[model samples]
Target: MPELIAPEAHRHAAWLQAHREWGPGAHEDGFGLLHDDEVDSPDGFAAWVARLRSSSGPDRCTYRWIIEGEQVLGGIALRHSYSELVREAGHIGYGIRPSARRRGVATWALGRMLDEARAAGLARVLIVCAAENAASARTIECQGGVLEEIRATEFGPARRYWIDLDTR
Candidate 1:
C-alpha cells in the first residue's frame, strides 16, 4: 500500500527517479519544490528537504511523499493557512508520477490530506486545477468537492472546488 511519508534525504535516489519521470521542470507540485531549488546534488537535496521540514507559521505547508516501500509514487501538500497565494493556488496540491497515473493514488492521498486539514481545524479547503485537467477534477469530485467557479489566474483558467470538511 502507498503511504505518505515526510521528505527524507535517504530517499534521494528514489525521489530522483520519480522526478525524472516528470521530465525537466518545476512542475512537481506536491513536493514543495521551488523554481530555484537545486535538488540534483546530495547537499542541495538535503538543504531542500530541510527547508520543507522547517516550514511553519500561519502560511506553513505540510508536504508528504506517496511511497510504497522504497519507490516514490507521487506527492501531496496540505497548506495549513490561508494567504493570497493560497487563494489562487488552493490549500492542497498534488501530482502523481506519470507511470503511476490511472490508479487511486491521488484520490487516496487527497483523502489523507483532508484528514490533515480537519486536524488543523480548517472547515473547508480550496482545490484548484487547470480547467482542462479532467483527471484532477474527477479526483476532487470523488472526494465530495463542489465546484465554486472557473476563474482566470496567472497560470491560466482553473477550476476551483471546495470540500467541506464538516460534511466529510
Candidate 2:
C-alpha cells in the first residue's frame, strides 16, 4: 500500500531512478521542489531535503515521499502560506513516478497532504494546475477542491482551486 513519509536519505537511490525515468523537467508541473542538479549527489539530495524541511516564510514548505516501505512512488510538498509569487504557485504540489501514474498514487498522496495541512493549522489550501493538466485537475477535485479562478501566469494559464479542510 502507498503511504506518505518524511523525506529521508535511504530513499535517494529510488528517487534517482524515478527522476531518470521521467527524464528532465517532466515532473516540474507540480513538483518544482527537487531539481536534477541538486539531487544528483547523495550529499546534495540530503542538503536539499534539509533545506526544504527547514524552509520558512509565507512560502514555508515541507515535503514527503509517497512510498511503499522501501520504494519511493512519488512526493508531495505543502507550502504553509503564500507570498505574491506563491499565490500563483499554489499551496500543495505533487508528482508521481512515471510508472506510478494513473494508479491512484497522486490522489492518495494528495489526501495525505491534506492531513498534513490540517495538522499545520491550515483551514484551506490552494492548488493550481496548468490548464492542460487534466490528470492533475482530476486529482485535485478528488480531494474536495473547488474552482477559484483561471489565472494567467508567467508559465501560462492555470486553474486555481481552494480545498477546505475544516470539514475534517
Candidate 3:
C-alpha cells in the first residue's frame, strides 16, 4: 500500500528549508495564495510549527507528504467540525513540489486523510478550492465530492463540495 506518514516535527526546519515553491515569502510569486505576506521569516516558520503542534489549531494536523522515503509534498488540515471555516479558508490544503505535480501524490494523500477522518467518526467532509483550480476540484470530485455551494469571499470566490463518507 502507498504510505502517507505524518511528518516528523524534527524535520519541519529542514523541510521548510528545502522547499522554495511553497516556502516563506512564496505567495509573492503566486505559488501560495493562502499564505499571508508576513510569514516570510524563520520566525514565521517557527510560529507555524508551534501552531501545528497546538491541539486547538486547525493547522495542528498539518503534515508533510512523503513518497518512497522522500518528502515531496505539504498538507495542512482541520478537523471535520471546522468545516465552515475550512470550506472558506482551509478544508484540505496540499502542495506537491514543482517536480512532483501531476503524479497522483495529492490525490493519494487526500484519500489517506479522508480515511483518517472517517475513522475519527466524521460522517461527511467539505472540501473547497479556488473555482478556477481545475486540478484541485478534480481531486476532490474523484474522491466522491459533490458540489454543494459556492461562496464569494474577500480572497476570492470558493467552490464548496461535499463528500458523504457514511454513504460510501
Q: Against the true structure, what is every candidate's RMSD? A: 0.7, 2.0, 4.3
Candidate 2 residue runs with Cα over 4 Å from true position? 26-37
Per-candidate clashes, comma-separated: 0, 0, 0
Output the TM-score of candidate 3: 0.73
- Candidate with best lDDT: 1
Ranking by TM-score: 1, 2, 3
Report residue 15 deviation for candidate 2 (angstroms). 0.8
Compared with the true structure, what per-residue lDDT tens digits does model 3 show for residues 86-137? 6565555665666666878767877887787788777887777878889888
lDDT of 1 by residue, 1-168 (tens): 999999999899999999999999889889999999999999999999999988999789999999999999999998988899789999999999999999999999999999999998999999999999999999999999999999999889999999999999
Largest TM-score belongs to which candidate? 1
| lDDT of the candidates, in the order given | 0.95, 0.80, 0.61
With a 3 Å backbone cut-off (N, CA, C), the pairs that clash in candidate 2 are none
Candidate closer to the true structure by lDDT (higher is better), 2 or 3: 2
Between prediction 1 and prediction 3, which has the larger lDDT? 1
